[model samples]
Target chain A: MAEIKLNNLTKRWGDFIGVDDQSLHIKDREFLVLLGPSGCGKTTTMRMIAGLEEPTAGEIWIGDRMVNDDLPKDRDVAMVFQNYGLYPHMTIFDNIAYPLKVRGTDKSEIRPRVEKAAEQVELTEFLHRKPKALSGGQRQRVALARAIVRTPKVFLMDEPLSNLDAKLRVTMRAELKHLSRALQITTVYVTHDQIEAMTLADRVAVMKNGIIQQLGTPDDIYNNPANLFVAGFIGSPAMNLINGSVTDGMFVTTGGTRLVPVKSPDREKAILGVRADDMHVHEAGQGDIDVTIYAFENTGESTLLTVQWGKQRVIARGDRHLRKDQDDVVGISLNQDHLYLFDPETEDRIEM
Target chain B: MRDNTLKYLLVLPAVLVVFVTAIWPLIEAARLSFTVGRLNRPGSLDQYLGWENYLWAFFEEPAFWNSVWVTAIYTLLTVGLTTVFALGLALLLAPGGRLRSSAQALLILPFAMSPALIGVSFRFMFNPEFGLFDAFFGIVFPPLADVSWLADPQLALAVVVMADVWGWIPFLTLVLIGGLASVPRDTVEAAQVDGASGWRVFKDVTLPQLAPVLAVVVILKSIFSLKTFDQVFMLTNGGPGTATQTLSHYIYFNGMKYGQIGYSASVAWLMVIPMIFLTYAYAKFVFRKADQ
Candidate 1:
C-alpha cells in the first residue's frame, strides 16, 4: 500500500477546466472519497490518479515516484470503473485472474488465488460463467473481485455502486467497506452519493466546480460546514437558508420580524443556515417562530414539514408520529448551537 | 386470414422473384451440365454426356487444372492482402478526429468505383512505357526501367491480384471501422488498468471481441475472391499465356469463347460447393452473435 499525493493537479480540455488546480494528500491504506455533483471534477481527479487521464499541470506521486509519464499498467494501480468494465468474453474466473496473469504471476498459483477472491465476493459458483450470463450485482462483484485479486499499490473505484438497484447498492456498499478494510489498501473512491462518502470514507473531500470545498471527516463536515455551499449540500432535505439579517444580536427575517437571539454583530445581508433535523416543531406559539405549513411529506421514518417563513420555505423534520397538513400553523425553534450564519456576498460562513 | 398466413402471403412475391432469378438458373445449369451442349453442333444440346464432362475436366484437361490452381493462389493473395491492409487502415482511422473522419469519408470513394474500372485504372498505372507506377518503380529501382510489367507471367498475375485487393480493401476497411466502434471502450481501459501493455490489451481484450466481425469479413471476402472475374477479365484478360486465368475466366472462355457450354457448366457448379460451406460458416457466426 502507498500514500498518494497530488501537488497542484489540474486537468483542462481546451478552455474548459475539468479539474482546476487542486492538491490533496491521501494517507496510506486510507479510504478517501471524492464527493461532488456531476461535472464537478471528482471523477476526473480519481481518473488522474489512476493514470486513465493526464493532468494538464502538476505532479501525482504514489509512494515516492512521480507517475505522470507512466502508462496505467506501469503504475500498478487497480481500478473498478463505473460500468464495472468486466470482460464480457471471459469467464468470471478469468476476469478475476487477469490482473495477476498480466502482471506475470506464476500460472500454478493463479487458480487458488482467483477462487479465494471469488469466494470473498460470494461468487465461487459463478466463476465458470461469462459476465453477460450474470446478473447486474453479480457482474459488479466480478469487477470488485478483479481489482482485489491483485494487491496493487492503490485501489480506485469510480461510482462502482451507482449501477445496482437501491437494495443491492446498500448490500454492496457494506461489502465494499468490509473488503476495503480487510485488504487495507489505499483506495480513492469517487461518487456523487453523499451517504456513500459519509459511511465509507475515512476523510471525504467534497468538491464543486473542480475545487475541494471541504475536506474532513463526515461528522466534522456534517456538524460544522466550512461554507454555505457545504452546509446546503451535505444533509438530506438540505439545510434551510433563510434570507435575513442580524440586527442588535437578533437574527431578523427579511419580512421584518425578530426570529432568534444570536451572538454575531449586526449585518444587513446574511443567510441563516440550519439543518432540517435541528428545527424543533411544536404547537403554534410554543416555539421561537410560528409559521403556516406549506407542505407535509411522510417518508415512513420521519415526517417533513415545509413551513412558510416570510416568502421562503424551510423544511423541518418532525417525529414520524407527528401529523400536520397544509396551512396548519406550527411553531419552529432552531437549535442555537447548530445554527449557521453566512455572508451573502462571499457565500462564506460567518462565525456567530 | 390468420396473422401467420398473412405474413406468409406478404412474402410470396419475394419468394417468386428469388425462384425465377436464382433457383431456376441453378436448375437450368444443372440440366445443361448433363448434355453435350456444343454451340456449333445442331443436336449437341440434347446429347446426354452424363459424368463425361465432369470426368474430363477432373482428369483429361491440364488447362482446367491450371485454372483451378491459379484461382486458388489468386483467392489467397487477394483475401489475405485485402483483410490485413483493411484492418490496419481501420485501426488508423478508428480514433476519429476531423482529419481521420475526413479520411474515413474518402475511403468510400474507392469502393464506389466499379471493380472493372479499378482494373482499367491499375492497368493504366502499370503501363511500362509512361505509367505512373511503372515510372515510380523504375525510379526507385533502375533495373525495372526496361522491363515490361504485363509481359511476364508472374508479374501479370501479381497485377491482377493487386487490382482485386485494391478494389476490395476500402469496403472491408469501412466494415472493420464499424466493428472497432462496437468494441467496448471501458473493457479496453479495464485491460490497460489490469496491467496489460498496449499490444497485450489488443490481443487479449480487443481482438477476442473483434473475432466475430473479422470472421464475417474473411468469409465474405473469400466468397467474392473465389468468384473473382471482373477485375481479372478487365486487367489481364487471362493474359501471358493463361498464367493469370482464374476458374471464372476459364469457365467464361469455355462457355462463351470455345462454346463448350456443358463442360463450363460443370466447372461452375463445382465452384459453388465451397461457397455453400462459407455461407454456412458466416450464417453461424451471425446467428450466434445475435443470440448473445
Candidate 2:
C-alpha cells in the first residue's frame, strides 16, 4: 500500500477554478474521504490523484514517486466510477478478470484470482451474467470486485455507493470499510453524501468552494469544527449557531438569553456553537433560557423538540413526551463542556 | 354499437388500401401464375393452364434464368461491397469532432441526388475515350485504357454494379452511423480501461452493438440492389447482350418494352421468392437475436 500526497494541487477550467490550491496527505491504509457539496472539487481531487485528470498546478506523490506524469494504470491505482463502467458486452468473469489479464498475468492465475474476488463480493453465481442482466446492487458489487481483484496500491472511488438504494448503500458502506481495512490499501473516496463520508472514512476532509475547510478524524471534524462552514456542514439536524455578544464574559442573545461559555473568558464577543443534542429542555423556571417548544418529532428512540429561544429556532433531543403542535414554556440548558466559540468577524474558531 | 362502428370506420381506409393494393395483387398474381392469357388480354376463368407458366419460366426460358442469375450476382456484389465501404466510413466518421458534420454532409450528398442523375453522371465519367475514369485508372491499372467499359459484354455488368454502389452506399453509411454513434461512450472507455487497444475495442464492444443496424442496412440494400433499374436504364439500357439486365430490367423489357406480359409476370414470381426468404431470414436471425 502507498500513501498519497497532494502538494498544492489546483484545477481550473479557463477562468473558473474547479479546485483551488489544496494540499492533503493520505496515510497508508487510511480510508480518507473528501466530502463536499457538488462542484466543491471533491471528485476533481480524486480524479487528479487517479491520473484521470490533470491538475492545473502542483504535484501528486504516491509513496515516494511523483505521479503527475503517470497514467492511471502505471500509477498502480484502480477507480470504481459512479456509473459502474462495466464492459456491457463482457460477462462478470471477464469484467473482474480484466486487469489481471491486461497486466499479462498467466492464464492459470487469472481464473483463481477472478473467482476469489467474486467469492469475496459474494458474486460467484453471477460470473456468467452480463451487466445488463444484473441489478444495481449487483453491478456495484462487480465494480468493487474489479477494483479489488488486482490488489493495487490505491483505490479511488467516486460516489460508488450513491447509485444503490438506501438499505444497500448502508450495507455496502460497511463492507467497503471492512474491505479497505482487510486489504490494507490506501483509498481516496469522494462523495457529497455526509453520512457515507462519516461512516466510511478514517479521516474526513470537509471542503467548501474548492478549498479544504477542515481535515481531521470524523469526531474532531464533527465535535470540534474549525470554522462556521465546517460546523454547519457536518451535522444532520445541524449544529445550532446563535448570534450573541459577550457581555461580562458570558454570551447573551438579543432576547437576553444567556449561555455559560465553555471556553476561556478571554475569547469574548464571538458566536456560540452548540450541537443539537447538547441542549437540555426542562420546565420554564429550571433552565437558563425561557424558550417555547414549538414542535416535537418522535424518532422512536427519542423525541426531537424544536424550541424557539427569542426569534431563533433550536433543536433539543430528549425522551420527554412533547406534543407536536403544543406551545409550552420550556427552560433550556447548555451541555457546559462541549460549547464552541468562533470569531464573529472571521468565522474561525476562537480556541482558549 | 356506435363505438365499434366508429373504430372500424376509422380503420376502413387503411384496411381497404392494403386489401386493394397488396393482398389483392398477390392473390391475382397467384391466379395469373396458372393462366394462359397475357395481362393486356381479357383474362378468362376458362383459361386454366395449371402451373405451365411456372414450369416454362423456371426450366424452359433461358432469358428468365439468366435474369435471375444476373440479379442475384448484382445484389450480392452491390450489398457486400456497399456494406463494407459504409461500415468503414461509419467507423471513420462516427467518433467525430470538428469535421464530422462536413463529412456527413458530403456523404449524404449522393443519397440526396436522384439515382438517374447518379447513373448519367457515372456513365459520362466512365466513357471509354473521353471519360476521366479511364484516365485515372489508366495511371494505376494501366490495362483499363484499352478496354471499352460499356461496349464490352463482360464488363458492362461490372459498370452497372459500380454505379449502384456509388448511388446506394450513402444510405447504408447513414444507417450505420446512427448505429455506431449510439454505441455507448462509457462502454468504450470501460473497455480501454480494461486494457483493450483501439482495434480490440471496436471488435469487442462496438461490432456487437452494431450488428442489428448492419443487418438492416444489408437486407434493405440487397432488396433495392436486386431490383435496381435506374442506373442500368440510363447507363447501358440493358445492352451488350443482356449482360446488365437485372430482374426489374427484365420485367420492364418484357412487359412494357416487348409486351410479353404473361412471361414477365412469370419471371416476377421467381424474384419475389428470394425477397421473401431474405426478409424472413433477417427478421429471424438479426432482429430476434438483438431482442434476445
Candidate 3:
C-alpha cells in the first residue's frame, strides 16, 4: 500500500538537469537503493519523493494518491538527512516526539511512543539531554528515532551513515538494515558505497549524469553490468576496461595482444571489462599473458597486484598469503565467463 | 623588561586613552552631581549639595517623574514594535534573490539617515495638512481622518514611537536576516517532512532556533530605545505639556535651558543604572556565542 510510483520525473535548473526524465516503481515494503557518485541525482530523486524539491515536470504517487502538488508534510514520508538535523534546543525525547506533538497527538500517547522509538534506537538514556550533548553517532540515532517515531508511508534516507567513522558506519549499516526490516516500511536509501547497496537494497538503481544507468539486484549488476559506466562503477578497484578491438571474435589489447575470445561480432574498437577478483594471478610464464607488477599491496583480506599490461595497468586480486614485490613478473588471466565486452564508441555493453 | 611588564607597558597607553576619553568624563559628571554646579555661577561646580538633587527629582519634582513615565512607555513600545516588525521584514527578505536582495539594500537607506533627520522627515510626513502618512492613515483608518497627529498629546507620543520604530527596523532586520541565515537549513526541512504544517514548522523549529538571536535583538533594542534622544528632541521637544519628554530631553531642558548642570548630571547618572544592566546582559550573550 505504501508503494511509490514516479512517472516522467525531471528536475532541471535552467540548463543544468538534476534528474532527467525517468520512471520508477518502488514496491511496497521494499528497500530500494539509489546508488551513484555525488551529484548523480540520487539525492534529488529521493528529495522529489520526499516532496522537498519541486519537480520541473512529473507525477509522483505515494500510496494510492498522486502527490505532485502536495507539500512535504502531506506526502507522509520521513527523511534522515546527512547532517542528522536534530533540534539543538530541545532534549532528545522532545526531538523524537516533535512530529507527534506538532500533529496534535494526545499528550498521553506521546511519551510511550517516544520512549519506544528511543528504545528502538538505543537512545532511551540520552532522552533528557539535548542533541548538542551527543556524539555524531548518537545524534544520528536521534534523527533515526525521530523518523521512526511516526509510521510514515515512506522512509527516505540520504547517506545517513556517511558521517560516521568506518567502523561505526559498518555497525550502523547493520543496525539500519535490521531496523528497516523490522519496521517493514517502504524505504529509499541513497549512497555511493557499493557494499551498503549490495547488503541492504531489494534493488539498486545505479545512476550517472542524471540518468539511471542500471537497475538490478547486487548479483546481477556485479555479474552482468549493462554498460561500461556500470561495469566500472560497481566494483572496487573498478572494473579494468582495456581499450582494444575485436578481430576474428577475439578481443585484442591496444598493444596487439589477443587477450580473450569474446562472443561479440568483430568491431573496430571495443573495451574489455573485468573485475580484479576475476583476473587470476599466476607465476610468470604459466598464464596466458605475463606482466610486471607495478605495485603489490596486502590488505589483510587479500593481496592486490597492480600489473603493467602493455600500455594499461590492471589490478589483480591474489590469494591473501601470496607474497610478491614490485617489478616481479606475474601472469594475469581473464576469466572468460566473467569478461564484459563494451562498444567503445557507445560505451554500452556488446551483449556477448 | 620581563614579558609581563612589557605586556602591561604595551597596554598602558590604551588604558590611559580609555581613562581620559571615557572614565574622566564619567568621574567629572559624578562629582558634579553632588554639587550645585551652575553654568552662570562662578565656583558653583565645587559647592557640595549632597543628595538634594537626587531626592528632589525622586520626591519633589513631578516633571521628573512624568518624564520617567514617558521614557519607560516609549522604550517599551519602540523596542517591542521595532523587534516584531524587523523580524517579519527579515523573514520576508531572508530567502533572498535578486529582487529581495535589492529591496534589502534599499531598506538600509532609512537607517542611514541621522535619527534627527528621521524625526524631521517623519514630522513632515505626519503633518495634518497635505502630509503623506496623514492622508494614508486617514484613508485606511477613516476614524483618524480629522485627527491632527502632533497636536494631540497621545498621538504625538505615538508619532514619535512610530518614527523611532521605522528608523530602527532596517538595521535590526539586517541583523536578524544574518541570524536566520545561520540557522541550519537541514532542521527546517526535517520539520517540514515531519508532517508539521507551515505555521507549526515556524513555531516549533524556526522560532526556538531563532530564540538566541531574538534575545540579542530585544536586549539591543531595549538599550537603544532607553537612550533615545535625537528623534524626540527634533519631533516633539517635550511639547503638548511634556507628554513626549524623554529622560535625555528632560536632562537637556534642566541642564542647558535652565542652567542646572548638577541636577541634570544626577538624572543622567540615574539613567546609567539600567544601561549598565542591559550592557551586562548583552555582553553575556556575546561571550556565550564566543564560548560555543
The best candidate by TM-score is 3
Off by over 4 Å in 3: B1-14
- Residue-level lDDT of model 1, residues B1-292, one tens digit each, is 9999999999999999999998999888888888999888889888898999899999999999999999999989998999999999998899899999999999999899988899899889999877898898889999988778888999999889888888889999999999999899899999999999999998999889898999999999999999888888888899889999999999999999999988898899988889889999999988997887
Compared with the true structure, the alpha-carbon lDDT of candidate 3 equals: 0.93
Question: Can you tell me the CAPRI class of model 1?
Answer: medium
Task: Show model 2 residue runs off by greater than 4 Å.
Answer: A5-17, A20-25, A47-75, A208-210, A243-272, A309-312, A320-326, A340-352, B1-12, B36-48, B95-107, B128-174, B180-182, B236-241, B281-292
Lowest-scoring 10 consecutive residues by lDDT in candidate 3 chain B?
Answer: B283-292
True contacts recovered per prediction: 0.83, 0.28, 0.81
Over the stretch A212-243, how does candidate 2's per-residue lDDT look in tens digits?
Answer: 99999998888889999899888877888888
lDDT string for model 1 (A55-113, tens) is: 99999999999999999999989999999988888999999999999999999999999
Give the chain B TM-score for each candidate: 0.97, 0.89, 0.95
Give per-residue CA lDDT, model 3, range A1-352, as digits (tens): 3999999999998899999999998999999999999999999999999988999998999999999899998888999999998888899989999989888899999999999999999999999999999999999999999999989999999999999999999999999999998999999999999989989999999999899999998888888999988898887889998999999989998999998889988898989988899899999998889999999999999999999988899899999999999999988888998888888788899887
TM-score of chain A of 3: 0.98
DockQ, cand. 3: 0.83
What are the per-candidate TM-scores when only chain A is compared? Answer: 0.98, 0.95, 0.98
